[model samples]
Target: MDAGTRNRLRARLVSLRDELLTQGSMNIPPARTDVVSTPDDDEAPLTHMTQAIASNRNRERADRLEQIRDALALVDEDPEQFGLCEVCEEPIKPRRLELMPWVVLCVACQEKHEHEHRSPGSRKHLGDFQ
Candidate 1:
């Protein structure tokens, strides 16, 4: 990739890192226990469920942030490897990079990777329910 394009991608990744950090800092405070527990004490479970969902969402974002940081490191350490597919060692399509700057695989390699990584039974059962 050109120096200009690399810089642009780095800037975008930095922006994304900031956005993820800002969004992931949110939390739902625990339910209060001042009032006596009652049969209708549904607030506790509902609050717990809400907190679980938020935790999961934040975790996903955290994972993505970590990936972005790693990509930045790769770009810094080896500029030549920045746009090459990890699996094929070939230049990834510029259009694919535009859509997913964090991707480490080209389209063909990604499809093969996904197929191998997925559960065989899941794909074999596509029409069983019908």
Candidate 2:
């Protein structure tokens, strides 16, 4: 990438990191204490589910923040290698980089990596559900 493009991406990463940090901490809902008091309450499960969903969303945000930080570090430490695929050592497409500046691999290598890393039996055949 050219110096101009690298600078632009670096700015974007920094902005994203700041935005995530300023978004405030997770607001996980407290577990329902009334579940025992009213065993017939239909809303108890809903409360718990809301808490779980909030926790997962926060976790995802945290992970994304970490990725942005890593990308920024790479940009700072190795300016020459910022846009190159980690596996193939080829320059990632400019459009791809624009869309996801934190990605470390190009499209082909990323697809291969995901395919290889999938757990066994994670995907079931359509007939399995029949």
Candidate 3:
């Protein structure tokens, strides 16, 4: 990638990192201290479900933040390889980077990774045989 594009991407990554941190801080649900265990508590299940969902959201957010940080570090450590895919060592499309600056794989490699990591119970389609 050219200097201008690399600079632009770095700026974008910084902006995105800042935005994610802000969102993470703002989205944290306050700690609940009013819940008491009761044999007939009807809302217990709902409360547990809500906590699980929020925990997942926080985990996802943290993972994305880590990716962005890694991308920024790579940009600084090795500019020549910044836009290259980690799995295939091919240059990722500029459009893809524009949309997701933190991505480390090209679209094809990403698809393969997802396919390989899919749950065992997932339906096998025609493409799975490939």
Q: List model 3 lDDT by residue over 1-130, tens digit each.
A: 9999999999999999999888863243434555774533676667667777888888888899999999999999999999999999999989889989999998889778877888988765434533
The C-alpha TM-scores of every prediction are: 0.75, 0.83, 0.82
Give the top-scoring candidate (TM-score).
Answer: 2
Model 1 misplaced regions, further than 4 Å: 28-49, 120-130
Model 1, 36-112: lDDT tens per residue? 75534767788888788878877888888888898889889998899899989999888777766777887778777
TM-score of 3: 0.82
Error of 2 at 5 (Å): 0.2
Inter-residue clash pairs, candidate 3: none
Judge candidate 3 at residue 123 and give its lDDT. 64
Model 1 residue 78 CA deviation in Å: 0.5
Clashing pairs for model 2 are none
**Candidate 2 Cα outliers beyond 4 Å, as residue runs:** 33-40, 119-130
- Would you list the C-alpha lDDT of every candidate in the order shown? 0.78, 0.84, 0.84
Per-candidate Cα RMSD to the true structure, in Å, reads: 5.1, 5.5, 4.1
